[model samples]
Target: MRNLRITLIFSIIILTISCKNKEVKSENKNSNIGQFRFIISDTLAYGKNLARISEYNRKLKENESSVIAVIIENELEDGSTKIDTFSDGLKTPFFGISKYQTGKHKIEIKVEEKMMRTKKLPNDSLSLEIKDIYYTYKFHVFIKDKVYISELNEILSKQMDIEYNENPI
Candidate 1:
């Protein structure tokens, strides 16, 4: 009888701990102090642009909770605007959009702060570096005269602290 009672107590403690952990995890997923967006500049032709957009959009839709619609707006020499897009939906309450191009380019981040609030960090290693990591709500990238809107939802950034200018020289 004593052994059974001890086992029952242990089981109750374990179940309580697990329930608390699950609650914390769900809360963290929705907590956000603010959001940001990325502006990248590159130069790619229309065909190349289309291919990149298709591949990136496919990957984002498959991976993330939010689906991004990539809008390609080209400013013609005659002052007419040409626009092309992939996917369809309203862009709001988005998880994030990624950077479209690789290598050197001018990239700017604009953070829209919600409200300042202090919160404890997660014990996981990834959460330790979350502040340095910027999450983009929607991306508006300019490759030459063509503007790619929310073309991607992932950025392959090697270093978080680094910045690139339009012209280094």
Candidate 2:
């Protein structure tokens, strides 16, 4: 009977060590960001121009839906232009000058979504602009809904530069 008890105790110790090791490995895996991709395309370009930006989220949930905001700007040579913003699942009207020279214009899209629950009121805002080209776009995602704003102001002053350039496209 004594020998059987010793064997049982040894088995229990080994099992406990194995379980702890497995848990440590699982935690390490969770610490790394999972893979994800965001597709951005110029749907109105008639298959001529396109761009895309992608990012990975470490804590992204498997069954969560993400909100995306897109903006397109048309720049003219004579120091004038138009701006447009579109949401992920909405259609936007194609508006632009009929015959305008197309140069190295700027196209920017800002996407923001809540990754985790927050107690404070959510006021997330992201804006993108190309100054020399005279174009800009802004997108804000809140807990309740999302907003898209387009403006043609002169190259954003230095103060607003941080907000526009730091946002993840």
Candidate 3:
């Protein structure tokens, strides 16, 4: 009867410890639920004018599944614009241009998983532009005009590298 009592006491102590540990883990998991954000930039120049490229904001959130959003803004007048959204299985690209004859413009992009509410990985963006120039002669002098065309490539090469290092996706 003494051995039976000792065995019951040991089992009760073990069960109590397991219940406490589970509570601690549940609290830790709740503390990490939120969205993350980052920023990126690039530049191009021609003659006396300069074109600047910067993202509005980069954000990732955990919902029914993982969702990533990228916001891109351009600060140039007369230049064009473009946006691209990318993931492991799909790619989407969009294009636009400045509204006025000269000034600043913006474009926004959002990406999310089809279904699920869990953790999410990191994402990337690539901005590119080609400037074209035309010249005409008047009064034995040359006059030059320029235009900008923009494109966004949804290439996740850098993200792949990070994943290769055993980092979060």
Error of 3 at 7 (Å): 43
Query: Residue by residue across 45-150, what tens digits does model 1's lDDT show?
Result: 2223222221221122211222233334444445464553333222221222222333333322222111111223578311111011112222233443235332
TM-score rank order:
2, 3, 1
Task: Please rank every candidate by lDDT, starting with the best.
Answer: 2, 1, 3
Q: Where in model 1 is the C-alpha error above 4 Å?
A: 1-41, 45-48, 51-65, 88-169
What residue runs in model 3 are displaced by over 4 Å at the alpha carbon? 1-34, 42-83, 89-103, 113-169
RMSD of each: 18.7, 23.3, 23.1
TM-score of each: 0.20, 0.26, 0.24
lDDT of each: 0.27, 0.28, 0.25
> Clashing residue pairs in candidate 1, if any?
97-153, 98-152, 98-153, 98-154
- What would the per-residue lDDT of candidate 2 be over residues 107-154, giving only the tens digit for each residue? 333222212111223475322211111112322211111122112111
Of 2 and 3, the candidate ahead on TM-score is 2
Q: lDDT per residue, candidate 3, 73-106, as tens digits? A: 3334455544432333211212221233332212
Point out the worst 10-residue segment of candidate 3 by lDDT: 18-27
- Residue 79 miss distance in model 1 (angstroms): 3.3
